[model samples]
Target: MNHQEVGKYWNENAQTWTTLARAGYDVYRDHLNTPAFFEILPDIQGLKGLDIGCGEGHNTRLLAQKGAFITAIDISEVFIQQAKETETQHPLHIHYQITSAAELPFAENTFDFATAFMSLMDIPETGKVLSEACRVLKKSGFLQFSIAHPCFDTPHRKNLRNAQGKTYAIEVGDYFTNQNGDISEWGFSNLPESMHNLPKFRIPRFTRTLSEWLNIIIQAGFVIEQLHEPRPSNEVVKQYPSLQDSQVIAYFLHIRCRKS
Candidate 1:
């Protein structure tokens, strides 16, 4: 499938996704990935930033709260509408638009920085998305993104648990197999049991190897700055026991790169 087809899935999922995400059902993002991504982020006070695949603008609002003027975009119209509704009530310095990450609607050197929160892996054209990000960033501008770890969160993954029912290791295969827009159906594991009847999300999967991601970034004129595998803190794990599995094997990867 192409980006448009992938976007249709997201659009269909927008309302449920926005509702659950806002209700804090996305535990990995809330307690692990976003925290780690922001920890390594450079200060963005007074900077102009673009949020690629901003979803309901949760992370975009975080950036804006940190004093950046943010332009946030997503391919799903309903997602953008939800984001705009929040912006209207909260009044952050955010501009919301329904736009595709692979084709940014801006001139070259238009932003000081850009960010994608657990979004890069959802989009079909990774290379084109990176190229657009690089093109729109000013000299020395950086782009940060997070995704399911290509090494561990493969098309085939299984968890090996100890006698205590705690994850001790992860079993993964198909590391070399690349997938483009394969449909994956699942619901947020952290959601309350009361929501068990909720329909699962149909997300398009776009998988690439670690080396392939690095090469794509390099080809898009980006110099690798840092790569992070986020592990939940002991305190966080205590609060969210399900996240303890992250300590055994990283479930997510964060990358920061500068336009060369």
Candidate 2:
């Protein structure tokens, strides 16, 4: 799919996605992605930052709380509207815009840092996003992003469970295939009562191998600083019993890269 196609798909699902973000229904993000991101995130006080694919401004708000001035952008107009609505309720020095990450409508060297939380995989032109990120960042500025782990979260991944309903092995296929399409399942069936009747939403993901991901960053003029595969902590697993399954396989990968 092309960028416009990808944007069209997200725009179609914008309402459901905004509802999920507002209701805090992202189990994987709350339990896994956020913690892993913070582990490597540097102090951003007084820094100007860019947040790409900032759906509903959830993470942008968090960044504001950490004392960073934020310019958040997304491809879906509805998503930008929803994010602005949330900003009205809880003011967080953020500027929300509707724009594509591939062609960032920003001046070069304008940001100290950039972040994309679980968004890069959904972007069709991964290389363009990386290049735009590199261009917009100031000299030596850093970019941090998280994605569905390329090594383990393949298109044909399945869980092998025992007769007692316990997961034993994680089976994966076509790990090297670079492709895009609808994902199996991604909605919160356990949302609050207000959202119980909400429509089920299927995510469209673009898959890439680990080497491809690295090469994209490197080719975009970034030096890889760190790579992280995050899983649930012991306490988190206890709180959310379903997270116990995460130990069997990594769900997300976090990468920190600096402009070279």
Candidate 3:
């Protein structure tokens, strides 16, 4: 979608932005649910941090509370407004900005850590964003981010079935764009032929394979420090029978790559 349309969508939903952030999305939490906030934050204590695509700044505030100086950023002015507004009495310092993920506005080696949560796939020019993240971090800084799994969460996902009926979702579409990863529409969970009538608002995602993603970090002079597949809590498992081990099936992929 065009930036205007994207801005309109967030503006329309701005009122509920914080509420949703705290409501605990199954998919997002599955990849990120943690014992302590600081655990996911790693060792960024006393270091500058950036939260890219920081809608409503939940994580930004969380990081601030944990004592990391933060710069929270978003592309949508509406979202940035909501984030700043939600932080009415926030004692800690948090700089908020309206900016694109692909083209971050920061000097080289400026941050000690950065994060993008469940927003990478939605971003166009993700490679550029990753490169920018690499550019802005201090030596040995951490760049953590998340996205939906392409194999399991893409529009063309694999389906599971049984004698009774279909048990899981099915998807079928091209993984990579014919062009330079500049997609215009992207949606999921429909019959294969539905692309004609229901062309999703294609959002360009550089179709990086698992190996390719790892290589991006290595090539950008970072090292993979951790890989986590955060499962749901026992409570969520009991509350939602569909979620085995609190795993929100099609939610996100959490990665932590450290600058060398």
Candidate 4:
């Protein structure tokens, strides 16, 4: 139930996760999360960036595409290997390493920016990870990351649906409970019926209150710049009906902070 164990779970999930995610099974990410994260992001052309928890280098490749020199890391060896394989084929010049976010291999002020797509909340040592992110960012550099909304996506959550099987509200509980390293099992909801038999991913849950996240970011030497609760646009909802539940409540949170 520690970070090492969490890494092992991710290692087990690496191949399937990468395959499904690349195949568009991660609907929320492709439809809402990643697009929202990029909307507020500053131009990183010619900058040196570090992507912590860069599973299979999906978002890292996006960063590289924006003209940044990227070094991406993930604790899972398989994840890094898959990312490296992608790099070999595409020749993006990205550096992929098997490294924990809580213990980065780089020196202080080494990167102009840093990012953790949806991986921070999965990390058991959130504070240490943020501290390491701060340590590696240059002065005025920013760290922009996204996570499941703490208020709605608690240790216990379910979608309340109407008679037509449309989600109307979210039922969430155990918000005050400490959930460090608790195991949660679920597969991507967007997978085709033929792939319904795929094994569920065993992911470690590390739930924290919104205040706790803010305090940790401040304690890590970051000044809060922007906080966003991303909801799918009308067009997105029409395209991906499953995301309509997000209109009832924010499903994801994005934060951008500057090294102070």
lDDT of 4 by residue, 46-120 (tens): 999999899999889999999999999999999999999989989998999998898898999999999999999
Q: Considering summed lDDT, which 10 consecutive residues are worst modelled in model 3?
A: 28-37
Q: What's the CA error at residue 123 for candidate 3, in Å?
A: 1.7
Ranking by lDDT: 1, 4, 2, 3
Q: List the residue pairs that clash in candidate 2.
A: none
Q: Write the per-residue lDDT of candidate 1 for residues 127-172, one digit (tens) a residue.
A: 9999999999999999999989989868898889989989988999
Q: Write the per-residue lDDT of candidate 3 for residues 1-260, one digit (tens) a residue.
A: 44434545555554444444355532334333433223565766688999988877766777787788999888877778877776666656898999887778899999989988766655545566788898999998898877655545443555455566434544535655222344444333222463346433434443455665677667777788876655556676566444542243534457888988
TM-score of each: 0.98, 0.93, 0.73, 0.98
Which ranges of candidate 3 are over 4 A from the true structure? 1-38, 158-207, 245-250
Error of 1 at 199 (Å): 0.6
lDDT of each: 0.92, 0.86, 0.64, 0.92
Which residue pairs come into collision in candidate 1?
Answer: none
Per candidate, the number of residue pairs that clash is 0, 0, 11, 0
Roughly what TM-score does model 2 have, to 2 decimal places? 0.93
For model 2, how does the per-residue alpha-carbon lDDT over 60-112 read when each residue is reduced to its tens digit? Answer: 88899999999999998988999899888888879999999998999999999
- What CA root-mean-square deviation does each model show from the true structure? 0.9, 2.0, 6.0, 0.9
